[model samples]
Target: MSGGKAITCPACGGKIEVRAAGFTVNLACQNCGSLLDVSLPEVVLIRRYKNAKDRFALEIGKRGTVFGQEWEVVGALRRKDQITIWQEFLLFNPYLGYRWLLVADGEWQFGTPLADRPQGDRNRVFWRGENFSRLGRDQPTSTTAVAGEFYWRVKAGDTANATLFQSGETILSREVSDGEENWTQLVPVDETEIENAFGLNRRSLPRRKAAQGLMQFKAAPGMEQDDLGRMFLLAMAISLFAAIAMALLAGPSTKTSSMIQVPVGGQIAPVKIGTITVRRPWQFVTIDADANRFENRWVDLEYNLVDRSSEQSIDAFGLVEHYAGTSSDGAWTEGSHHGDTMFGHVPRGTYDVYVSGSAHGWPVDPAVTDAWGSTETINLTIEASTGAMSWGMWWTLVFALFAWPVSILWWRFRDK
Candidate 1:
């Protein structure tokens, strides 16, 4: 102020001043509606503009050091859409030139003018090997208010075709008017950062809406989102690979399938099954015995497997029912005649299995089945098998693990 040229307002005859006035070109008269030209040694009049509709939070002429550089809050221009209005404060640093901070509903965006406009393919803006999404179609944004000194002559009633794009937390904005296109890179700033930058000692600031918070600030997803996405992908990959490996391990090398017939009320002689030669590489041995009766009846098979060398008998009791009936709800079917079980760490020894079955849910009157001319005794054919391993539970866990990341990405994009 001391080294600057002292001049009186051309319209009010009041003192017109510029602080740290190095390259200041235009100054607004506070006492009168006059835009003063301060480029020359003697200040002159430009044109008068209207006062702002709302008072500003950051006072004009207040100096603050940001990013190791001191800046003065010089000019401010308020812009409005149909129903929403926000202020853009222009900050000037001697060496850094001019930047702007747009504040809307306590959300802030600090932007710097770009000398070159970004390239866009179709509607997507591309910069720094990243893609940006557009906020809306380009439209006119009108300037509603003007105040303080600026490097350029700006006034109310001027309009610019503006468009905003988002890339992570950064926003790319373009404004064009009268063949002049201005591009800026806007970086989101929260209330804490804004308060610290302006040295405000307030305890709390206004809260942003949940909807608006998505677009108002934090224009891009931070590292946490990217890290989560990568983690989910890793989980899917690892689980998929593990599942395939387990499927191969659990696949049976030799299927020793045999059959035996048992009377409905009687038992069948124990039949010898080949010993499992699979060693520790296979986690466990799975045994499957499917008992089938030609009639529509349930066969409850009391079964047991014995290691012939150790003489340790393992109970393998199971049920096989063939039920198909038409109900009011729909056609219903339940219970397959296939029962499977698994044994952990079965040693390499000859195995023998015995099965005794009883046919239940049979008509007390044989007359009912005799009318259909069926036999009195139903034969139960038992088919036995063994696998190298059992990984049904493990497969379920792996599939669930793979789904976690997919669900996260689903919701993330859905909301975004």
Candidate 2:
């Protein structure tokens, strides 16, 4: 590899080569871990650290064709947020200027700095006619390690505020520092492509010791990483099929329906609707009551299911009300004219169903009359079903099935 200039490390008296001589401003000593500012004729030491030797996938002066352009790896940085650490490589070409290669979360991305700033607020931004929405919150990032050369002055412990916005597969990153604000567009690149370009052997690459230590702990039995995904997917498929079957076979199959007239002046007497036999061990019993087109009036319905063999009784209630009036905001209506009550897990038996209810006026429950000043009667339609399925139970089962896999995924993401 050839470079425009070379210098000696001020702290360790070791040789340092500057690949981008005139444009390169700062660099870290590969031998002594000392940060140096080489923008002037004389070399000035910025910082010194104990840890110097760090392994990188790509080394300085290594030239590769990335995205059809030959770029030389000029610098590398190891940065970290509160939770995870990642690596960044600065690639440069004399004709194309500079580009960035980022490796994090077992993924690789290529970044290009935008000459024109994006337009919009922090939450959303528009660049080149594409809208990008922000993901997560702004995070503080610290440069934990530095190597090779950079165009701008950089040192270990340099901090910046970073925010990421995404539009489809492309990501836009904004980093604000004390001196300047920079925007870079990042697009995901395949790991194989990166490996092929940089002549990297991924299998033999050194792993982060801290991450390896965390992976040493064994996972719970039956909850192995390989089986978790398969189990979750299988369970989801079963749940979906069960849902479709229930939608097709489950009966709210109406057993009986009747229209009963109730005088507004008095309480309604119990009327025997019919008997419904439940063959299943347990099922939901539903009662639907509707008072059609009745305004400013309500009907309260009570149901009684008396078991023939056990002589046991189960009671349920429902209400049907509707009110309409004109307000400052124009005509408005509230409350439904129809309502239903469901009794879940009813034991299998023959039950004689009885319906009784009362009707009254809204706001003021006085005796309503007809044109001749006679008591008015409101008609209500009551329906009964023995085969009502419990949707809540189905959803609860699905959630319980999905919980294990989702929890495991969350844990891995958080600790990664």
Candidate 3:
């Protein structure tokens, strides 16, 4: 969808495209050296990607049985020239362990066949449901279907013990002493298993069986009563210890010392006035106040007449120069200024104070033609000290009082 009207550059009148990446806007113009503001449209497009690789083509379907259980082909069997790779899907039964097979084929190599063997030698392979021991040995114990090729070395004697047998009556075996011969198998699993293993289930399983299973398990009778008494005793001990600790730690709460005294009838406190001038009509100056020494203090300021003939009263048009203070580190502090008097507690350190006010909200007055009175600046500084309090400690005590009772109740009832 189209966005709002495009902005044109002021100098060159070129069309500009404006797009927002996050909080900021990106703007660029194709034509001239003009500054432009690009408008963003309301609708944007999102894209989705597929899992397949670029070169290989795929066809997906199900395959037949392996080890007497029906198996599925999770993905297409890949083929290039004469080589083929087949992947099989694994089905897991909690009652049974893991089982699956994958196969790869190129041109089979011919080798010498072993001839003589003792008669009456029998080798057989059978299916054994699942092996819980194997499950316990691997952490994150759960049934998962993994797609990969696995190689196993088999010998005639070793083949007799296999859980899965080949389709033929005789079992193929290799010599143990001459190094193991590798037989490779591959298993392809459903892509959905990746999400399932990660607990992202598109469909919810029925909970009836789970509910029945939970119903079969229960705590011993009177266990709750026993647990309750133990919890109560623990609560009493903790409460007693906490009370004693608090009493011991509560020695004498430190009192905030009063402001350093200046001798009676002594010299008026020196005031350091800082001046901030606005260069542009729309710009305002930020005031910084140190609250550490002067928190919740009062400051008196008088705007000295620089050129009285052109001087104008800033308060006349229902607009006063507004000043707001924030902490040195950028925390907002509450303070207020009216006319020439400002009062509030400021935290210690540097502050970013915002100052703005005019007959109109706009910084520049269009009708103000008198050049001498048009350019105005304000000067400010500290005037007097206000009383201080240990606010952090006081608030901490208040929070503790409010929370202690709740904490005690929670401790008493936790086991129940």
**TM-score for all models, in order of appearance:** 0.47, 0.50, 0.17
Compose the digit string of candidate 2's lDDT tens values, residues 1-416: 24567799989899888888878898888888888999999999998766687767777678878788888888999888754578899998876788999887678889999999999997799999999987755667999778999999887789998988999999999999996899999999988888778876454343443534324332443355666678788889979988887665554453877888876646778998888877777777888887767788888788999899998989988888888999999999988878888998888888988888888887877654457777777888888888886678789889987876777566545623
Would you list the C-alpha lDDT of every candidate in the order shown?
A: 0.64, 0.81, 0.27
Q: Which stretches of candidate 1 lie over 4 Å from their true place?
A: 1-164, 167-255, 262-283, 291-296, 362-381
Candidate number with the higher TM-score (1 or 3): 1
Candidate scoring better on TM-score of 2 and 3: 2
lDDT of 3 by residue, 125-179 (tens): 2222311110000011111111111122211112111111132222222222334
Off by over 4 Å in 3: 1-244, 251-259, 262-416
The backbone clash count of each candidate, in order, is 3, 0, 14
lDDT of 3 at 56: 14
* lDDT (Cα, 0-100) at 298 in candidate 2: 81
Q: What is the lDDT of residue 109 in candidate 1?
A: 84
Best by lDDT: 2
Over 4 Å off, model 2 = 201-416
| Best model number under TM-score | 2
